[model samples]
Target: MTAEQKGARLANLWDKTLAAGMSEPERLIYRSNLLGSDKRITNYGGGNTSAKVMEKDPLSGQAVEVMWVKGSGGDVGTIKRDGFATLYMGKLNALKSIYRGVEFEDEMVDYLPHCTFNLNPRAASIDTPLHAYVPKKHVDHMHPDAIIAIAASKNSKELTQEIFGGEIGWLPWKRPGYELGLWLEKFCLENPGARGVVLESHGLFTWGDTAEESYLTTIEIINAAIGWFEKKITGPVFGGDKYRPLPADERRKVAGALMPVIRGMISAAEAKVGHFDDSDAVLEFVSSNTLEPLAALGTSCPDHFLRTKIRPLVVDFDPTNPDVAGTIAGLDKAVADYREGYKAYYERCRHDISPAMRDPNAVVYLVPGVGMITFAKDKATARISGEFYVNAINVMRGSSSVSTYMGLPEQEAFDIEYWLLEEAKLQRMPKPKSLAGKVALITGGAGGIGRATAERFLREGACVVLADIDAGALEAASADFSKRYGSDQVRSALINVTSEEAVADGFANSATEFGGLDILVSNAGLASSASITETTLALWDKNIDILAKGYFLVSREAFRIFETQKIGGNIVFVASKNGLAASPNAAAYCTGKAAEIHLARCLALEGAEKGIRVNTVNPDAVLRGSKIWTGEWKEQRAAAYKMSTDDLEEHYRSRSMLKLSVFPEDIAEGIYFFASEQSAKSTGNILNVDAGNAQAFTR
Candidate 1:
């Protein structure tokens, strides 16, 4: 490929035969998905596409013009037919009569429902008018980084003219609303030959006579920007990196160490999830000399800063010197200063109708040597926030290299951030689940009890990291949970709870992947049934190593993470009724269980002051779906009782005071009680789910 051809890397992905089969509205969906599939074209849920189509009116029995556009909060890339809102073209144009001016643009949002065609329940966004007034068969407005770099530059207007001549035009800065839509209409009328326009400090808008033309035009415009920057930007990007980035492993270690500390500070009001980014682009920007100054300008685009707060807090660790301890020590004051500064910004920009001040903590944190860390209400939002910041970094890289990079004016940013309409949108959101922002690490997580508990937590909106010794079970279990709960909410680690290093590494994985750990379920175990005289030293040691030492190793790691976060944590130990009741010929198993129960009591005493709670759940006769019972223990125990292995269940059921049998799910509920706030005030307590065994009474 030639240099110019190579520079234009974005391929026109439209399939002509496919478009030939789709209706106009279906074609709109097709075009929207094509444009949104690439982040370079638009960030997630950031852009809108529309198509004007002729449809048969159900009421009038005549062909009527209707505009189908992406609905509010819908991502174009994943949207289906139901995701677009249809509005009567006549009703939409009629809105122009009652439309006051820029000041009353927000009120126009109320009138959108009145223009609904065929009663599309999908609400229209504020950008509806922008597409409605374009006077074309198809229109697309996108936030591609390459185009936004020029649009966000100091001389964006001049750059547009120089790049595309009269075919594409440039418009001055105007906050998106009905007024901006009118401006677009006027621009189209005056410049009849124009194919598109660059909205200064905003994004690009392209139109065409067909859906294919409009989609292709959007791609070509973005590639033009990319190609121009490749040739025009000859200088070192981001003022050349001032400090070399740490090795990838070292960067991750620092991020893991810092995330829990930061999450603890910011998650006071509401639990927040964390996302870390040390991609090449992020590393380049965070380690650069101009990182501080450019970050101070914040972001030019509304979508960029909205998810990533108004500005990021630049961490004070110099990569060359590498003082992690010093950086952590100073974070207390650094966070306080950022919060105070944000409050001051709110106070200065508040209007009578403005919404109340939101969380003042920085959503984005720029650590020099490592990369970027973002925290939000949930994992998806947290991850998306990081992705948006990377887009901003790319835009800044280009604009700063060629022309002066600029951020949105503070007042405008404040206005948009605290806008009453935005506030209303937030209010419309549904209430969060019980464990919405909580993350858990379940040991022996591929086993029956652990799997049940993980599913329970996941159903309540918590992110789960399943750590198990069984490689095959872990993979299958992880894939199952990931399919049911989103992949973002589920992760797995191959961990031997008896190995201190493996246990610690599992906790580290939990911290970096989902911010930090909140709950630890120590469920890894193996049972041995043998008379004291018959039990070999190896059997005794194996029982103690896995059941007792394993629990200790995992809990120690949990305590370390919980202490670093300074956030209260939950540790639920799955012991056995054998801990209290004497079971014949299983001396080693009973001794190991007793040790596990006692450890819970000791840890509870030590953790009380730190708000960490340790509790024990004693389960017995959990015969169904149990890995331990499937082994020699079942035959050995049955042999000692003078019964077949099949009769062991009947023996246990008949021996119980309630004549009931226990299952893994029963133990799962007992553990859940301790993990949840339902048992918040009661710690160091034991809950028995052993079919009411009189011999196992804790009281």
Candidate 2:
């Protein structure tokens, strides 16, 4: 097909060259990855695919039919060979004898371990039976938007027939389990010629004799649905526009202004990361007259609402008037109402066996004329939740245009949301780290001390924004962090801390990126070793400008954000031991450091009522990886001590009472202690990380 033709349809990415040298299981992985590479076919971790392969049993040493399927909690797009669980087909089939009806179907999950082939440790997902019972050699199950659009319509069954005719069948909504497996098997038996079936309000399943055939069939079926929708949608979707979106820049400003407050309000229980989406679909939906009604009805696909929740809370705002302040003022009541309603929903739908009520905060929030906001425990999840909602928007657009859209039934949704098995999965998850869900911004982030601190925070589960005056270094550092941790857990901002406008803009960017700040590490600094007599006015201004004024500017911006959030914040100052103890010949440096230390004390005194904490970590010397040890400062300090630059580290180490060298990681540890809950109640305190420097003691 031509490129234009492919653009209008799902591209068949199957390559015979790529598939020629692969094992059956390997081909399944390849096909699954191809199918999942596009969000149009499947959302992140939302779909499963399988193939039946004959492999020698580890114990019996005999070839047996083994079902290889995407393991539980695995995403098909990134699935490796090990991601597929291997189950013996004979054992899976034998499970039908003990099938005690739909009510007891959940118990069927327990027996899956017995069906494990070759003692594969990967757990079989609940969808295993759905794939296992299908007699086809390969099956592809997906939550494609175009397919689900038909599946979620009020006339879904008829629409399915209209779209695919006899090529694909339709099955009414049945909670996926062993029972649903039987339904699929029955459908396949009844319509042996049919290639696929669309599960009502769930997704699509297609099968073929080979992995490539199944993958191609899945995409082709979705492409057909896409073509049908394109031809059928006659007018504007969502009843046309009610309000045009704010200008892009204005929208960002609004998001930057609003997210922190919302994040702070909802983050009382646990810290959250925020994701903002103003995509074309989101804008179209939010600006529509039907936005409120459509959003209230909730998303149709189960995968969509699993992350987005059943429905979104539409923010009260009129784009025509653009009253951001007014909106902020009214947000408290709106948020409170949303929580109460969510609680009532939990109370109304929860079964006695249901897990306890979870956080009542809405995951997805819609702003008319701006876009969508989603908050979650981490940035990736929040971002994915927004993406899922966008898929739901597309689903609603298609379903509503061709026919009436229908959300999943309340009881069915509740059952799935609070399913005991789902609860067990939640319980089985590892405990969150101490800094989990926290957002931090570190100035001088490209420098050794700053990068070390950020690495520590990222390791402990905090999302970090790396801000620096050096653009190249910032980019390099950001890239390194993204490689080590993940892009979702870190962002970078080019910031001249001494510039008020730059600092303000950087903080705003940080707020918009991660949904507000929780920890601010004011580590940006430089050093000079000039005597009081030799320190020129230019040198004095330079030191004071960056060290003193820069700190003030960043702190003011952080404080402004902290006030907006109403959540307690943390500020860790990477000051110098010279701040407390006199340093010979380093008059300007000592004064600047002294200013940073005093500023922390004053900020602590002023912010204690609001739960903000300010603390200082004083280091005598951190030469390794320290940017301050470069250029003239190192030579100046060395010459002042009557030594060469190479001997400065040794001289400082020997001069310390503990006779130990201090590295950037040591300063990072001190900063971590103050920034974390380890010092939750202590503020205006100084930590001496100078290897037993008696002169810099807090006393």
Candidate 3:
């Protein structure tokens, strides 16, 4: 087919995608075809697409529905309905109302629990609210090759002005998802009739009342930019016309040396599912240019920075030099310099946030004589690196003729790739604890503390079973966690901690789901407050029956079955509180907390014989926004503490030596330490995260 015919066919497919009143699965299939049809539109999983579906609300007798957004790490070209996280629209809208006029990211994390979608296999898109805010039936966002070429141009604004005229709106590059979504939200509210949005230093977002308009707008915008570049510039003619393929023996050697590093970055499962593309596109780009000029070009877009660092390693080896040691040392120095630069960038952006993993040689770009090889732990990551370098080369070539290309500034690029919003996207998914290949059961997994602990364990790389009595909350939390983490990493079971049979069944379910349990977080509990005189038997019985008895039952099962049977060392953490030792107005709560602490101590002593380490985290007020501190609870706590709601929060923070509020994340860190190798020699400990709230002399 002719080029124009191919473009038209892709456009027609997009039209069909929007026009057809198909089910969610069918729409995903069509969307994938349209995006895949044009190499310029999307490569592999570079973009995201979503559709809103109507379903009955189990809570209210209403026909409320959700938008099934594409999950993380899933390719848009092949994503299915199961891959789309079902974010309840009503819940999202409600959250927006509660946190009215606040930033969308804050709203998302706060209201994440209300959404009824499972968290595994699917996750709400990082751009979930952006798609939701468009007021369109369907939304399409992509990193189109043609658009990136134009955006990466020296005269990008001028080029866009000439091609799109006044139809396109340009947004200065901000971190995507939350900040970008907010900016787009305001821009859309103002313009109301914009054709599409061109995110400078990022990508394009196009939408319409119908999916076809959104898709066509994306196509037209890209075509216009491509046409302008073609008209304005001419391609360079190379003198070397002879095409020579590398020798078969040498090619095999090159591939063999690189395969191990590549395989480590991604999964064997993903490698089998998708075709690896370490082809001429990547090799040609690496060998075409001088190392220095190529490094100066930056990434294709800021998003690509996560997969492929800002640039690659310039492998200039002199095999004939005879001093092999000197050559290897020189290469090592180059890599060390790259790592130093990365560290400087991190330090500059640091604000009490923990540091991310640093990969010194994300990509290795060899010279003309030497073959190129990209390094990633897996094929998926390696392919991402390969694709990014290929795109960057194209941009560099296109811009060199016209003018120097300026990419995202260092800070802006850092923010895009490492922003909390993006990190939250990865965290939303469930995984095994740091104790990978081990089994864990998190009680009260539906609650704030329990959920935080569960997410932390999953990230550390362990399979988790989240058990809770609140079935609705459990389902919603599980759905949200699974979307980013994957369904296999976590499972949800409904169990009332007060019932022995239910607790037993929950453990059985966990063992069946994850092979066997090795860690137990006895996190299930209540938090009702009442004066000693006001506290009744009912409240006392309720708190003790669950918090105290629940801890004993869960720990007992782990010691007998999981730890002893596997003959592996195990860990048990009780989510006790600072209030357990300190005085509190809530009589029942204080009694339960104190008993829970004693139970942890007893269990720790008993489990020592079975090679299980039991511990507890005495957390101070974890005041981050969530349902626990919503509305009256927040206001009342603030009032009783003799400060404005906001100021009252500062008091809790001031009590800590770090002057930072004790976040659920801080408690999770403590949990991780106990479960990690660093704490292997230690056991029967109580980690206090109250920020020095309890002085020894005070009691």
Candidate 4:
């Protein structure tokens, strides 16, 4: 059978499955499995689906209804009945009445007491109310690649209009959950017959009276948009002549140098929000492009601004000059220009409504030949923004064939970029307020440790700057965080910690970017294990440079500046390991960690006089799914120990006195305490959050 026939058969099967009079629980199970099975429909935990089930309450004579929405932390495709949070529809509607125009996080917290659930379940979807507001009995949302591919295009509005016509109502991107629900509620009331709501820079939301109807409508709408986009943006095959390969060594060097900056930028975006998207296509596109202007195209979607800023750093590398200082200076000037232009756009767009602050939430990096690096906090966000740029580039290139694809006017783009309502939604999130006025810089922020630490700082109210060495990962991570936190509270930078000049420049840039730094988490480091006999000088130097010297350089520069000028007693938390105090089989790895701990101790003594507190958190075998314990290293350790991977993991956990695997989040909490006023009298202290493994002092 043809592909179309196969799809039709699947659709028919889905319809029959739901029509079998399955209970709500069984229906949800089938629906989730169907959605999860298709990557083209949803990614790992990417999309959400919900069904409004009406049931009679035991106590009351009147019938009670609850929205069985998808719970947090579960993949839509594999979600079960328990994954749905059963919320009283009346309570949610009542919340709308009491908190009309009020902040969302506040509403969520205020209504938490009224929600009758296991309470231990992850928080409800940010799009809960939006789903509840849909008049249909079932609702579905997805980051379908084909749909978003069209949405990311510059002419998405036009394309959407052509395909969906009056059936779709478009809503500009807003932080999801309550605000999105409110906007969706208002739109539904206004456009009575609207089949679906298309969130610009976000994803599609469709609903229907039946489960199959909702699912089918979603697929149909997305397919329509994809068809329209493909027909309009066709291109001929250009292979051999178009492909250019760089020398392997040069490519590696360029990739290494570019990684941290891109990662940092991405991490910063996520620190504010809570999530980002890291699609495979995004990573391939950014890494493959080796041109100047083409690389400068900003994020694939607006949500990416939450990860990688709006644009990338434009690098003009001149082989003849090879002046690092000159190249950096030029980049700085370009950023300044972009910021000024952004401000001008905001000013022009401002009306009687509240205006956005002067700071540009995102940055565009222009790296000549190596393409552009779009950095954010989390992979998801960076991916979305990167996808937006990919689509924009397609439009720009495709438009050259047709009429030029006209982008939103500068003022219009600025209006949405700096929308006060969107900003307000972020300000109202439910998070701790300890780091409110402080600025923090987190390195290696896209990884598990970096992401957790950044989240901790953001929770305590710190305006965080997350930096990392993996540009793609950083952008994806930063985007995720920025969506949860306000964009203003977080910014990402791309910087290499090993380079003294780069470190200094990054710090200075951060100081200017966030006003001044108050908390510095020098959390970026690496671990490489080699038996003493097999250790090479090159490997030793690389490990020491990244883990030991890198910490020294970042702390030295940040401490002096914070002491000399700011006079604001800053907090510096270096992520060390139990390996610093205990002997590990890997000599170079242990030495580098030991050196980092000593450096922290010395900095603590020196910074104490300036009222700055420097401390370190020693975490051992934290097993938080980081790169250190993945791939070859994990396999090697398991083999050497003569145990299965699961056994090895269990052994590590059992070694901890508390019998709990040390989590990056646990270490992040320790960092938070040291950075916040809670540890006001604490300085130069080494806190071991290794679950008592350190007390035993065993390797």
Candidate 5:
């Protein structure tokens, strides 16, 4: 296309965005979408966009100018109008003059609400003032990797001017707040021709009288910086890839071996209790040879400083090192050193900020051969932090092409890390679900009850491993769950829970996959319905081995992992209501379930002091979608009961006091309670999810 034709087409597209009769907020949404839709421009919650629009004040009956800025915590990529907060521009700007004498915390936080024209629940982005201070009708702020590559480099200021000349303004690193906003406002006024300002070690900001102008200016400037960056490079960016990675299998083995050791140490120090996060991406990045220096130099930008911290804690990974005393002692010491180093870093600058020392634990842990692992209070944050680091690595590698990559000075990083407004973003967040950040293992996980339980735990934000003897079914279930709740959070393993070796290997491998295990749902079992006159020794043994012994084997392995980590875990057994009220022609099944229930009680008593909680969920008839209630087993049971399969199902459902059929999902809820903190003070408890089976209820 001709340049003039292309410009006309671009103008038409821009006009389409404003579509006739659209409200100002709608236009803002349209423009924000343009900025957020590109992950290359902004990731998850890494950027904010705003528009200055006039709206009628319901109480005052007068038109008022308001700043509609992106709110805290939601991803801009999918944000709605409600995702943006409205603050009176005049009021917000007025605070800048008087904000000088106020306590930095109060000035930064306490007065924010009074300036809100529509004081809604959502908090405005920390960059609200930066957007408001600009006299333009629209503003765009983003952490585009290309711009960050330039802004985070050692000679960012000089290079920035070199690339854009006087068209861009430069603001050295300042934590986002009223002060930085005021500084930006003054800079823009002084350099009215500048298209945007690059906040050093932060991100890019562009503005114009219209959304189209601001958005295009952001794209145009970043593109220019990237073009300049490409021209500067004369050689390989990653120091020529001198490092060779271990084979994928070997990498997994190494990661599996070292993750728990790292997790245990960090969990104890940072969380005080719970498992740390480990992922395949982290493994790949840490295993890369470039990780050490790139990470040591610190986060690529300041926005990331709050998420990934200044530097990742690097752990030495020697595959030849045996997994005995020396290895354990060395890893423990490495973690201790990382913690102490962080404390020293904090001590050097804590007096500059008012907030107490944030958790001194490393958010990112880099291991030489194995890979990197990141930790957070919850799985989402862990995953997000890991992603940011991965982006940082790529940006830093790219930055090396032009010049050596360097992050903000330690003091600047420290300021952003403990900045009260940044910390308050976390404080204002709603509480997470009970099982968030937890790891759960479900045996017979391909089966109905097991799959339901796995789904429940995953929905509550737990990393789940589905362990089943049926390899085909296990693969299918794993694929479905992984698709639903991220492959990073779901895993599947094949194991005969009745075999000690298989159980041990399964639990060990799962613990390696997720850093550690927090909850075990022993739901694997076999069902047999035979009278004493016809029951065979094999039938009785099969039921007992799987139902009773399977629970024992799996729970024992789980306890070993939990005990090693000392994180206090949970074990939930899916027992049958038959254990409570035995039915005719089910001797083997009843005996096995009865034994399992009692075993759970015994484990509850034994594991209490160790912080392990054991509980049982007794489910009656769960015929729908159950693998156990099919084929020859179904035929045999129907014949024994002298009723057709349909009749038997109806009979069970109607017999319940609630006259409703029980399902795997119903049993799953009861099991979830025991697995979550909801039952923190309860143990040895038996919950009957049999649709009001009074006979199965236990006090």
Candidate 6:
């Protein structure tokens, strides 16, 4: 295909969106998704797009020109019509009248919300006014890495003019807001023929009469910038023959050893909030010979300071033969020195006599050649910040080949870091989910109850590691989870909880994957129905190994990790109602479950001093979607009830006072209460999720 044809093909890719008959807002969604789909353009929630469209106001039944800009907090890649906030164009323009006389920068935020034409409470992105200021029908804004690489450099203005000539308007670094919007508007009107505008230390903006034209323009400019950089810049910045990367296993070992220490140091000790997720690429980059000088240069741009802070904290360590214990020993002093250095930097650059400092802890931790660990309020944020730094490294590499990498000066970084408008933009983020920063380990995770609980914890924002004995079932369940809740949020381990080695390896994997554990759901089990007279030795042993011994093994390992991390956690056992009230032909099953409940109580007592909570969920006959409720055992239970399998299911439902069927989801809900802070003080408690089973109710 020719160049034009290829460009058309790429633009058409975004056309597969919404329904056939698309509204203007839906088209905006399609375009935003197109922009977001390319990582080179923007990371999740990093860019904004807008379109000026005429829509009928529901209340007035009159045509209104509303500027639908990308709303705050939604990933541009998955944005829908609702992702764009609709604002009255006339009202937004009216703000210009008072812009000239404005005294404070924060006053823009106070009045910006009032410009909304739609009654929806969604806040517009900080760049909404910038998009609104443009007179074009469609405007595209994005933080393309290639574009930012040049824009954030020391000679950004000189480079821009050399590359794009007078076709692109250049603006000095200005904190984004109402004043910036006014400045951009005046610049655009004066340079009407300019294809786009480059916002130094920020991002790029392009516009056209149609979405295709605007999107294509953005692609063209970014491609041009990337092409120019490739010609001007040369070779790898970090990797060399002298600096060897650690073997995969060694890297993982180092990461596992040092993550907890880094997590503890950077974390808010009182709140117990932090994420120590690692990246192999990041580790390699940090460990390379070129890291020392490159890291000190600061972020690629001012916009990133919110995520990456001013610069990374480089902790000294010997990567060749890592001293895991020694590294751990030095973390306190290393972090202390880092905080002192940061305070000194702040004091030297403060605009006021007593400026309020942001978090003194480092967001990105570079442990020389060993590895790199990033900490944030949660997994997602830490991952995003890591991404920004990786991009920054790339930008620095390119800029280094050409000349020295000069990022936003320290004063500029501090201004953006503590800017009230920027702070307010973050404050507008939606409230976090219940288990936002917690990590959960769910055993028997591919099974009915296990899968349900894994999903439940994920929905509440916890990073979940699903452990299952069946590798196939675990793989399938993991793929399903990765699709629904993102791969970062869920992981799987092939573990037989009955095996001491398997249990140990599984918890170790969990700690390595997510730094540490917060909640342990011991739900992996099997149901056995055999009378004492007819019970087989094999069946009794298998049941005891899984239900009784398995819970003990997993709980024991969890307790060890909890004590080591010093973050008191929770353990929830999936005991059955049979343990509470004995039933016929279930002697082995009842004995095993009874042992589990007693074990939980024992641990609850011992763990009390450490603030560890242990609780049990006694679910009775959870037939729906239960693996144990199928095959020969299910048939035997049906036979014992003297009814068909369907009838047996109904019988169990009718046995409950509420006449509701028990399900894995119901059991999961009970586990959630104990796992979360909802039951902060309720340890050793039995939550019966049998739909009001009086016999199973805790006395």
Q: Give the alpha carbon lDDT tens digit for every residue of 534-617 in model 5.
A: 889999999999998988899898888777777678999999899898778989999999999999999999999999999999
CA lDDT, candidate 2, residue 202: 92
Give the Cα lDDT of each candidate. 0.90, 0.90, 0.62, 0.62, 0.77, 0.79
Per-residue accuracy of model 6 over 1-699 as CA lDDT, tens digit each: 111111222233545344346877777887888888876777777878999999888879999899988887778898887777889898888887766443564576667789888586778766778889888889988887677777777788888898899888788888777767777888889999998888887789889898778878888888787777666645554544234656767766776666665664554542223334335556546766778777887885654667888888887777776777887888889889888989988888776533477678888887766556677777767777877776676566556656566787787788778776666666767898899878899998998999999989989988899999889999999999999988778888989988999888778767777777889999999987777889999999999999999999999998987876766889999998988888889899989999999999999999999989999999988887888887777988887778998798789888889998888888899999999988998998888887786766677
> Tens digit of lDDT per residue, candidate 3, span 44-83?
6777877677766665767766776676666777666666
Candidate 3 stretches greater than 4 Å from native: 1-11, 14-21, 36-39, 59-61, 98-107, 117-121, 237-280, 288-291, 317-329, 369-371, 400-403, 421-699
lDDT per residue for candidate 1 within 22-67, as digits (tens), equals: 9988899999888889888888889999999999999999999999
Pairs in steric clash, model 5 = 282-372
Runs in model 6 deviating more than 4 A are 1-27, 53-66, 88-91, 101-103, 118-122, 239-242, 264-284, 339-359, 475-488, 531-534, 580-587, 637-662, 685-699
How much is the lDDT of residue 663 in candidate 6?
Answer: 85
Q: Write the per-residue lDDT of candidate 2 for residues 389-463, one digit (tens) a residue.
A: 988988898888889989988778888889898889889999999899999999999999999999999999999
State candidate 1's TM-score: 0.97
Worst 10 residues of 4 by lDDT: 1-10
**How many pairs of residues in model 6 come into backbone collision?**
0
Model 4 earns a TM-score of 0.50
lDDT value for model 6? 0.79
